[model samples]
Target: MSQRNRDAKRSAREALRAQRERDRARAKRKRTLTVAAGVVVVLGAAAGIGVAVADHGSSGGSDSAGRVIAPKGAIGKDSLVIPVGAADAPSTLTIYEDFRCPACDAFEKTFTPTIHSLEDSGAMRTEYHLVTLIDGNLGGSGSLNAANAAACAQDQDKFRPYHDVLYSNQPDEQDDKFADSTTLLTLAGKVPGLKTPAFTACVTGGTHKPWVKKSNDAFNAAGFNSTPTVLLNGKNIYSNASLTPDSLRQMVQAANKGKKPGTVTTAPSPS
Candidate 1:
């Protein structure tokens, strides 16, 4: 071949090589962009999942500390009242009691059986407003702790049994036995399924302490200065001099007379 022809062939080969290099570079840039877009999508999905989890935690009856807040329709901010009888019982009896109060223990001992009987018989339903009075009168977390644990028990539908047990096993008003979560758990063992990890976490972490304080605030706001205060049909029955455990049934019967058998006219009265 002539020298010029040979040079032309070499130039063509060089041009082909340059074109192949450009194609490879373009493919590499496309691959890099695809990988980057995939990373961005994955990161976006992870961030969205994080936000959903956080939203659920906040709105699902939990406080910022991950503690259970008061259940709906709870009286006075954080006080949980488990109704003992029919939902439509005519006469409503409200009891404001503290776990650490000796007076409350006496009141419970004297009236709990009768109250339960009345409740079972469908004559009346009782609303118990748990307070932490002894914690204020005495210097300790016993009342607050016990009340918190009791509120926690409500979450498990064991509030009534646990309430009875706490009153039955009341320590001295000043002993502060309820301050220890272990003692509360030991008591909870009496109720079936009450000693689970959730209950333990609630009691030990003082999850309901803020709720207990709110209850106490409600009690104070209601002008009650004592524990074991009882009200029947909006009347302060305990304030009456003739009130007795034996007379409680008669009072409920009288309150229901001429009124509907299952009509409660008032919300829970604070103690």
Candidate 2:
């Protein structure tokens, strides 16, 4: 009874120990799987949140007003050109300017009356090409923002007045105040019946930002490196550094000598 009983007892003890070890291993595996699943769930949620934020950022923010800013007639290069006066005027006066440019402000302040006079008298037509060179060169959104707002103004047939007002109230080049849509809308109030909800939405939502970008691209493609570039009858009038408002009128008169009023003229090549 001694040796046989002792061996059987030892075998039973070893089997029980082995079974307990196997159970412990299974429990450890289960816990590891549960922790791994939790980690995956957490990572998935974090990735989803990251994607949502990225989408919001890329969408240029939400437009609460939901107003559509449509383009007016006579869209020129990049659909940003706002023409004034008779569309078929005898001579064509083209102006390339950036809202943040000081020289452009000076030019506009000095020559705006003369240009409008010619336009009102049906002597010559004008084309305004808005550019965002400041935004590209200075690393801010001012030029683009102003140009976009101006384009929006064009939608309401207020481009000419809005354009003049922008130049009149242009901020210092480094200020970047035009980056705020509220400032643009405030300036729009200068023009009669221009401060509407649609215009506000357009300015605030950057509705014409893509058009502004395209206009900028067109300016670059035209080989212009600076602002306040003026052309008359397809020639660079600003090239004559001594040109004045009076001289500009005389030049237009000369260019319109043979051509009749409301006569369409070809656009000049960039100098």
Candidate 1 accuracy as lDDT: 0.69
lDDT tens digits by residue: candidate 2, 63-167: 456432335764664455778878878888999888987667766766778888888778998888887766655557888788888888888878888888888
Per-residue alpha-carbon lDDT of candidate 1 for residues 39-110, written as tens digits (9 for 90 to 100) = 877887888843122211111235767665773345533445656566777878988878987766766766
Clashing pairs in 1: 88-262, 89-262, 90-262, 90-263
RMSD of 1: 32.0
Give the lowest summed-lDDT range of ten residues in model 1.
51-60
Per-candidate local distance difference test: 0.69, 0.71
Distance from true location, Cα of 86 in model 1, Å: 1.9
Candidates in order: C-alpha RMSD to true structure: 32.0, 29.6
